[model samples]
Target: MTAEHGPGASDIDESRIPSWIACEDLLVKMREELIDRAIKLLNREIESGHIAVNGSTLFSSEANADVEEAMYLINNLIDDSGRLHKEYSEYIEKNNGKKLSDAEAKKFGELQKFVLSVEQLNMLMEYARVLSSWADAAGKMIEGKDTEDILRKTIDKEELRKTVLEFFINDSECRVLLSSKEIEAIKSVLGA
Candidate 1:
């Protein structure tokens, strides 16, 4: 007896499925959020006098080296993340209007995970940069009284602090993570 062939026997042709633009959009949003968070963290460190004041060092020489190593890792992550993003964009452009299989969607989801990892890495790097800057400033402040004068003249620390905080809180990307009420609270604290 011969079995009858049906629709199940024929492979479904889905070469017309449009790629999800939302994935790329979300990745972009995530990157913006990461950058904003970094800036906010940096501002917080500065405002707390962690970076601007002369005091006992937080990280010793060995610890400082370790911290730098961590920063290097984060920088690498950012570079790799950027490359992945470029690849994703290229794939989307090349396959525009083309239907992706379920397997492809799953792969895209995995790629998104990598994107998030990079976002986290960026935040870490930003934190490291803030700490490094603070350490340098503090060292200068310790060097001599003239160093303090130089720092004061070079950047109106107070003014710049306020401005940076304002920019972070008012940023369009930041507005989503922070509510209007929260933003107001931050502004009040920053004296913006």
Candidate 2:
């Protein structure tokens, strides 16, 4: 039988779930949640015995190989996502521990850190969204069902895209986070 991921083997016990995260370290917390979600998504597929859908011999070598391949890909994607966050942190540290990057970063002046924090959070959410999309596809491949609910729970697409725009484009609190000039650099960095 394929293995179920997370605490308590046969099924995940809800008590072992991580606590409600605080906004202080939102980006870091998101990365952790994203990884947990990917694992859970894949495990659900395994438990459903939907790893291979072509009616391939459930207990055959081919079926096992298929499951292994899927697991490898998901694991790799999660690893890369974590690596991206690590690299971003290193980039910030290398820039004199200034979360806002160099003076060319933007024009928040006294509020540069706050503005940059929002930007960085947006980037992390975008990354999580991509990973969630992959998980959705994986779910489809296994259960052959709609993944709207799963995707929503893992990463809110509308919030990631639209809400961020509103926060950056209109919200007064976030208005000074980045100056007009710095936004261009952020756009380039975030590939907006």
Instruction: Give the residue spans of candidate 1 off by over 4 A.
Output: 1-73, 92-98, 142-189
How does each model score on lDDT? 0.44, 0.40
- Highest lDDT: give the candidate number: 1
Index of the highest-TM-score prediction: 1
* Steric collisions counted per model: 2, 0
Worst 10 residues of 2 by lDDT: 17-26
Q: Model 1 compared with the native: what TM-score?
A: 0.36
Model 1 steric clash pairs: 17-99, 51-134
User: What digit string (tens of lDDT, one per residue) describes model 1 on residues 1-192?
Assistant: 113222112211123311122212222333345554554543444464432323333344675654444444445556676776688668756765667788976665555554555565565455444433433443434322232232333234555434434554665654455434334444555556
